[model samples]
Target chain A: MTTTLTASKEQSCQTLLASGHTACTGCGEALAAKLVLGAAGSNVIVTDATGCLEVFTTRFPQSSWEVPFIHSLFENSAAVASGIEAALKSLGRQNEAKVIAQGGDGGTADIGLQALSGMLERGHDILYVCYDNEAYMNTGVQRSGLTPFDCMTTTSPYGEFSWGNKHNKKDMPGIAAAHNIPYVATASVSFPKDIENKVKKALSITGPKYLQIHSPCPLGWRSNPQLTITVARLAVQTGLYPIFEMENGKITKVRKVSTPKTPVEEYLKIQGRFAHLFKSPDGNEEIRKIQEIADRNIEKYGLA
Target chain B: MRLDLGAIAKAGTSKANQTCGWRNFKPIFHQEKCVGCGLCKIYCPEGCVTMVEKKKYTVDYTYCKGCGICAEECSSSDIEMVVEEK
Candidate 1:
């Protein structure tokens, strides 16, 4: 069946998330948004939380969204999306459009977690996408629940007394899976096709779905903007971020690391956020710990 | 460019805002080397890269911020990032 649902290359260029927004050059979140929206197609309503995507895409006089879009409080996008879905069902238009709730890591893993959990438990037909850049980038780079250990943020500055964020990144996808959502997946901006396919698959399911996308932030991570895709690719290649899909609380697919696996240092050294980790002996020890984290993920997920 | 206070602007009106001035490097596409893989178009953050007949690609510089993502992501090295002439 030739459903125009699949995102062809030409169709992807004219997606619901149009070009010419004020997102920073080479913004991974912007790219991920485009890919996700393109895959979801025009027949969708989007609910955006207060974050970089919302701020840059909907700047008063200009909007990048072409579909029905709504902005809610940072902590209420999932709730807002549930209401939209319920209204669609009430109007007997439940099949007319899909509802998508999107936000950054801060909104999804921290501020909005309660609302998201409520929506999932209620079994709403909504898709919640968390663009995890690992920090609260729009609010001037604050440390977030999803922030990786030893990563520097404005709030987790590296200095004599501290070593960046002292906590491990929150396992958001695991949390979502534990809720027994119909579908849950982890993706990266580096793999556009993978991201698109995952979104399409999530939308095909009938109940609550969650997608956590690893979107790189050049400004917050202090990496060159041109290397956005490269950075995202290295993240998965290094095993720091495993790309996988779960269905009915079971692992269904895994993107394995090919031979000659990339080392964690290769991924960490590119971004200035981890630059301090390469400077001192203590920093080297931290790098070792970070590698151990990646090694554990590799072993657990069988990524190799 | 007059926008009423607290009103959401029309979709895609940012096209009126010229961002080419922000570019320090411009991506030049070589049609001969392009294999029509469309990876450049896929990875372009601005979504300004247009595919001609599914084979040739052209980038709209009007809004291209010279991020060089297309050039960096082009698998065949068909797209070159050149310093913009001031």
Candidate 2:
């Protein structure tokens, strides 16, 4: 079943994401970035960290970016963005241009954390978007800080005694807000309008803004690629990815789940990473732990 | 003894471009019945809220942006949004 999403009220999704990229079928990361760029429009400079989104979208000699895009090291997208913004400011062209930093889970949550923190602390006039697919998909799906506990990755494979990742995903949004930036938000590909609206708002705002976007990776997660958007939608439904925004280091708004929150199992069962959580006797205990984490998140976010 | 006030003087809104309508005020607290779970403190995005005492908390209004999270997450209906000032 193909979903015909209505064009965003502010921008069109069609040409922004465009067609003929190298992304695997149903890549949520690509969709998320595409919609964001579409909303951002032209006159924007994007700095991308090396990851699935970067490798898949841009091939040497062939490019898919409709706007000015720069490819940077695995952990320097934020710093690169800082430079871009500085150049724009130095030339007194700040008002005419906008800056964005893009990366995956590893680039944003792990390897790139330092640069990301520096960029935020310095309060550069740029927007940083982390397309979180949980693992470092570009690097063969290894576990990353954003990887949820008990989820299986290439590095954290499930076994008779092992339950895969042991730690919960790091709270990057909180870390970003710690820098005292102007705006920060958590969004999902499921909510295009919200993400688009946030991007538009961030474009206008000075200072730094961080957006953690929940994208779904099918190849890495052992799920159907077509379910990319659906998986992201369920993530919010399950209360795993709460849609909220923080301003000046305080929670300003949070979007509530529709009710009768989707069971954690419903989300886990769809992805191969969590398949072991239910199938094995030892996995059940880990599953319980994972469920508790989700419950805690629901309570913490008031998503009931 | 020379004090370079340049850093402080140049640190108004110019170093950082202040955005408009970027923040919304949402007061979140269980005013009377708060158990002071402090869960909000743990999950607060900015970590700006602090516990005044037992079962009591105060938001550093100077930094609070009114996310309404304390009210939403508080099991008790004690946390609520009150628009006082920016």
Q: For model 1, what TM-score does chain A reach?
A: 0.96
Location of the lowest summed lDDT over 10 successive residues in candidate 2 chain A: A1-10
Which residue pairs does candidate 1 place in steric collision?
A: none
Candidate 2 on A184-228: residue-level lDDT in tens?
A: 999987666677778988878889999999988887888865355
Candidate 1: segments with Cα more than 4 A from true spot? A1-9, B1-6
Model 2, backbone clash pairs (residues 3+ apart or across chains), number: 10
Docking class of 2: incorrect
Candidate 2: regions farther than 4 A off: A1-5, A8-10, B1-86
**Cα lDDT of model 1 by residue, A272-296, tens digit:** 9999998888888899899999989
List the per-model TM-score of the A chain: 0.96, 0.95
Q: Cα RMSD for candidate 1?
A: 4.0
TM-score to true structure, per model: 0.95, 0.75
Error of 2 at A255 (Å): 1.8
